[model samples]
Target: MTAAGYITDVDYIPGFYPQLAPVAMRHVAALNGVVPPRIADGFRYLELGCGLGRSLTTLAAANPQGTFVGVDVNPEHTAATQRDITAGGLANTRVITSDFASLPADLGEFEFITLHGVWSWVAPEVREQILAAAQRHLAPGGLLLVSYNSMPGWAHLQPIRGIIRQYAVLRQGDSAQRVREALAYLLFIRERHAKYFEDNPRAAAYVDGIVKQDVRYIAHEYLNEHWTSFYFAEVAGMFSRAGLSFVGSLPVHTNFWDLCVRPEFQELFRTTTDRLITEAHKDFCANTAFRWDLYARAPRAMKSFEERVREADDIEFRVTRAGVTLPHQTNLDVVTSTVQGPLYQALLDMMSTGSRPLSAIVADPRVAGTPPADVSRAVDAGVALGLFEISARHVDTATGEPRGPYAMPNDFNRAVIASDALSGRAVAVASQLTGTGHTLGDLDAGILNELVERGEDGLAPRVGARLTAAGRSLERDGKPIKDQTEQGVIMAQACEAFCRTSLRQFLQLGIVSPG
Candidate 1:
């Protein structure tokens, strides 16, 4: 092992994952009627193994009231993160280059601690240190978010992982080259009609998919010296040692038993009763390969069913997509369900003007007779389907006034939008409303940047000129338009769509103001 006692030569890729956002955790907690850690403002957040620190820096930009710190053993990663922080003018964030095992105790406590795509890839000693840090640095009632590769689903892929790791060790090259060699070795074995590959068709298919994936991701996932996938029960046990209790999964839909497991296993899950055992059984039922879990120093008691319904009533919902239709289908793991008809349509209609509290949605004339339970289920279904989003910002239960985190544009999003004017490659924008990031296409980002700078009148001309300068011409019916006049016409149409659809989403997400 290197002096750091962990693999450092092969750095993890820089990627932004919205699942790591504190708002996502709070949203899930709120859905369950449990009080989440107070992260609305003035919260200290820490991220272990924060590669490139994209999520942390973006979050810091959005929540200037909060303090953010990221720790990574790689100096190169830390340097890149520092550069990003400086460029974004984020004063509330910092990155440290140090192994988890040697993290300074004097760094102070944090209310929100996160480690994404790290636990299953690091050595056991490193994991021990991480848990130790959680026990020591996590303040009372703090939340710990950890994501890892989980089992039963990974059972079919474990042997493939072993083969790749073994082959990578013998190859001499950079991490990407080693990943290519390992994938080639697997392909060679498959070509020979190896008994292992013949016996496991799914494993062969997984190997085929891995061959096509980015080598950087492959190297971090498979080329690591130590990697282990855990069962849900096993992970729960490990966290228990650190004085943390598993609250629930980040995706609110995962907490709904009926939505995750097959019908046949639902009865078994109900009878199991124990949360840990039920989670494990659900994993087996769904063949779940990955999990984003939330743990707390002490789990708060959930409100009674009626009280939970009342709490849910005060929360607001917004349709993320414009002109969303019904007959929505939600597929989580192996479980799939379809939601249709007037109930969802009415809810969508109510949100068309702007975000409305669920109380208003439940009381709407069109769906006034619908049962509260049905409304809740449909809302959850819509959220899982990505047609609707539940805002982290809460409303005062009595007065119906906005409470908790209020939506506002932030420096990080402005920086991202400004950067898009030159690079035009960013695919996400930070959403202050949700305390998370939202995805947008390169064209949409370019148009938003131009609109921010030049306003509505200059939007189409700026976008068309940018596209022309980039050697990109608009396409229609699978054919590129090369004529200057035709290109301008298409660009105008594209900008109009952006104004109608993408711009509305930006307004809802708090990435930009309506004006």
Candidate 2:
């Protein structure tokens, strides 16, 4: 509850999210007349409100051939992002600290521009500037990703925001304390005014999850000065004004679910286009707050098959040079078992073409039924297994080196190995943090050692053993170091919290030490 307890990036949870970008890119690629600038490598990506650039780093790591630029007004955030970029040796990623309004006149063009966690939190003028920037900088047929708090789901939070805003403004110097107070007040009101949530487990569950988030996130998300939520119609109009059209979302499942859940919903909304259906659905759902939108500049052409193939070929070259593969697993049988399923068979079918970008495969007519998100997940799995490799063309060579935009992985020959490597490392890292008293450094060491012992690939572990060794050294010292706890219980809790909280994706991979 203390102001000193606050962390910078932790508070502003609004920032670039890379996981959804691949799906957005795929949708843009499929649009009419908007082929990516370079069919083979050297694609550009721009992120607005990049925060500390965590997502940008991940994207840079995943797609080595691509170039990334993150723009933000927060000097502290940009500095931190630069630190990470330099430390990770991700030469392909760059950060710029500047207000959106003053973005360079010729910021060049980007195939993918992301405004994740930005639109709803900025002032109207700032939002307009961002749109203008995107309009000017996005390539023909480029992708624009925007996420916001949509209606229906946002209704319940509206009251909470109203209450918190007044309180947070009064306690500007201590946002965390203000958040706790606001939460306590909400809990008190819920005791008497509870209605829809009490009857709906899903709603209750969602609220509970939010409450459990880091207090700083609660403060920034709920109590910000310019915080606002919008309807799909409103956001769609904004995108149109920016010269972008709504495509689809990575959470593509939910968009389709509306039809299945209501049966007639799709038929009734069939006449309407994507934005209208999305708006109607939001109204039906009572204004769901969180969503990711896939938008692309209109008046552009879809990427050609030859161009897609060329991009895939470049991605393959980068991956091979990096020598990244999946993790090695003790229970190879279990993983092998999973691979025999329809999903695995489908993946194998794609990999049979040797190394190819997952995006390209998903776009192919044979895989037309497959969703872009699914392809991303599959590719991520492949990367973990050491079956695939990732490298930035510029990272290996100088900035002038020619490289394509797409990221490719190894074919079936390395698929299992890559999968095992990636899964094992992810699980090992997750396990060490979730249940063991190990640091990220420890997890990194363990995974890297495993990878090396199994077979030395060129993928060097970025995280060093220093953090883990330092933790032990600090424990030996015992005296207070910053705000870290001295008590054994506190230390364990802190380590676990740090691990579980920051590395949430590891949990999704079924990694995590014994609970």
Task: State the lDDT of candidate 1 residue by residue for 420-482, as single tens digits.
Answer: 543534456666556666767677777877776666676788888887788776777857777
Model 2 residue 369 lDDT?
76
Cα error of candidate 1 at position 291, Å: 0.7
Per-residue lDDT for 157-273 in model 2, tens only?
Answer: 576677666765666456788788777766665555577546644645555676777786787677656778887778888878887877655443333433223444455555665
Regions of candidate 1 where Cα sits further than 4 Å from its true position: 1-6, 305-315, 340-346, 357-382, 385-387, 394-409, 417-426, 454-496
Error of 1 at 336 (Å): 2.0
- Global CA lDDT of candidate 1, please? 0.75
**TM-score: model 1 vs. ground truth:** 0.85
TM-score of each: 0.85, 0.61
Each candidate's number of clashing pairs is 0, 51
The model with the greatest TM-score is: 1
**Model 1: per-residue Cα lDDT at residue 343:** 80
lDDT against the true structure, per candidate, is: 0.75, 0.52
